[model samples]
Target: MQTGNLLPLVLALAVLAYGLAYMRSRAVAAPLGGIRHLKSLPFYYAARASLWCGLPALIVLALWVAFEGKVIQGLVVSSLPSDLMPESEGQASLILSQISNVAAGKLDPQFVPPEIAQAGSLLENLRNQSQTFKAVLVLLVAVLGAAFAWSRVAPNINARESVETTLRRIFFVCAAVAVLTTVGIVFSVIFETIRFFGMVSFWDFVFGTSWSPQTALRADQVGADGSFGMIPLFTGTLLISAIALLVAVPVGLLSAIYLSEYASKRIRATVKPALELLAGVPTVVYGFFAALTVAPFIRDLAEAIGLEASSQSALAAGLVMGIMIIPFVSSLSDDVINAVPQNLRDGSLAMGATQSETMKNVIFPAALPGIMGGILLAASRAIGETMIVVMAAGLAANLTANPLESVTTVTVQIVTLLVGDQEFDSAKTLAAFALGMMLFVVTLLLNVLALKIVRKYREQYD
Candidate 1:
């Protein structure tokens, strides 16, 4: 059976096991007077039975799914005649793809080699047998596990402790999976980045100002001495992000302050939702707005003031991105300001301080950590924005600090580098991983700074 179909079957069996176990527990208790005499409630016994029925079966299914393809492919390859066997990994992959296409009816059998047709037939037969065995074995295991757990349930059994222990271990495993997934991603990016650096000098990539990354097909080819310098991309990213922050922070912060501190309850209820609606708008819609509306407006305004500007400029993208992240800042800051202890505000006011003084001295400081967190989040959003920039700011990678010029960001370059059918070993493709590694490092540093600020402010308040 397919994994999706098997999952529902397993869950149905678990539910059946739970119901049976609950009835059994009640019957055993009724003979011994009542469930009060039992060590744990009937719910625990049913839960334990459900866990036994589901957990082992799910684990086996997972392991089978994980290794199924490799094991099947190995068997099929081994069965192939020596003369027809692949000599390299790439050849093997091509053979597998052909076989898969034939098996799936995507390729005509008469067009393929006789060996490939035979292999496709073998693959289909083996897959059928594998699914049949998998379904039978999983169901058998589920039944056996449920029976064992049902036999163990009695008046004196501590089913609560057993269930709790199992749940605790499951939670720990989930946390471990999350951590290990992160570690795996980091290592994979690092490995690709190392390969990228082997092709391009680290200094040239980091410090050089040129940004062209098209590699030459031949050494004699003209206009393809690819420069992989990342400075221009970073410069554009920071310029746009700075513009976004300059636009977002004051407006968002002031809106938050007014909403939390001065607005009536009804007004807060109505206005906050309307304000936060900006966050729900699709980024692609924002991109369209940036391209069709904001860019033209900025260009017209700059021309009116006798300033030079590109039709697609960073300012247009940054302004729209700032508008997009406004809710992220205002909502978080407003919540943090509201969470400040009311006594501090009252104490400042009691000392003959005005409303603004109390707000500045008592409330803002108390909420500074959270407010900084909001700003950091908005900054990250702005830095990571792609659609808005791609739409409003042309992908020129201009190393200029001017917001009125066309430029591209690291993220835009990364997307450009990996957009099509590209070989992974090429510097052009691997550069994406290097860029990702740098972006990850930059975000990590921001997170660390945010943490330090939160800790410092938390210590002061505590």
Candidate 2:
């Protein structure tokens, strides 16, 4: 009876109707008819009938769910006594909730006046009416769809081909939706970054040496000039990512080699998921570990070695990030290496090459394309990592290669720029978008290059 509950009831009825239609279609025609009677089978007819009966009703239910709250609120606001209505938006929402509760008989009558009571009754009636209308509409659509499907169903209808074509279209639409969503996100980042560039010169942001971002809030305030140099941030990002890759690539790649080429199946089944546990660990936890454990350890080691090291060193953050990326590289690379044909390894072995030799010379070369793909993917992840850098790497944007010094990364800068208070139109907030766009472009390029390399190598192996 309630509008909130109508969608589920309608879906249930639609499913029930589909089941009945399917049964009727099947009863009328056996799955395999005499050689002259059918093109495909009876189940295909049932499936077609069921899909037609249920899909349209489900679509309508989805639309009603998406917009019903807005429609109900508009109706309620138009019917309300202006004097009794709450002034603030927050208060209005609370009032609406109270009114809904009253209509549902969940609220006491003493809290509401006679006029409010009449309004509650009207709301209840409206809700019931709306639900009835939706259910009837859905039922009518389902019946119409079923009737159309039934009319099309005959001894000679190519139901299998029709179902396959429909399914293919659905899958293609899903793929398009996914691709469009990614493109939309990239465009949004680009547009906002362009707005930011309009406020700050592209050359200054990219090439300037200084990195301060604090600025005065008002136009009349003095000393509001903010520096927006990105060179230092980008340098820091590269340094950290390089260090992480250095740490992760060797360990990850070797582990992948062992798993793919040498480890027993029993060992692999146990070790693979255990290694994936590294990926599952929260970045925030890694952040604290880097800040508390790794940073201090690096600082102490630097002091012992007669070198000055900042407590919050870029090395510490990068090291932890590397550990974090290991599973990503190892898991992906292992799978790629395993996918290489066994014949390549066997051919080398048959020529009196040792197992290690075959793995190193034959399997490794054959799998290089996929391995590069994994490393590129891992590099992109390292570039995008945020939490560990924010917590461990100091905010100062230093353009030095010395890993012991405090430094910042693009992701860290973005977090610092947007964290607390921000005006959407300010250069400071907009800079985050620019940084994001740069990051996106870099990752996209890496992926494209990796794919190209993989494809070329794959052709050679084939």
| Candidate 1 pairs with clashing backbones | none
Weakest lDDT window of 10 consecutive positions for candidate 1: 216-225
TM, every model: 0.96, 0.83
Q: What tens-digit string does per-residue lDDT give for candidate 2 at 197-216? A: 99989999888877877777
Which regions of candidate 2 fall more than 4 Å away from where they truly are?
A: 1-18, 30-36, 65-136, 143-152
Give the TM-score (vs. native) of candidate 2.
0.83
Candidate lDDT values, in order:
0.93, 0.84
Clashes of each: 0, 0
Residue pairs clashing in model 2 are: none
lDDT string for model 1 (269-336, tens) is 99999999999999999999999999999999999999999999999999999999999899999999
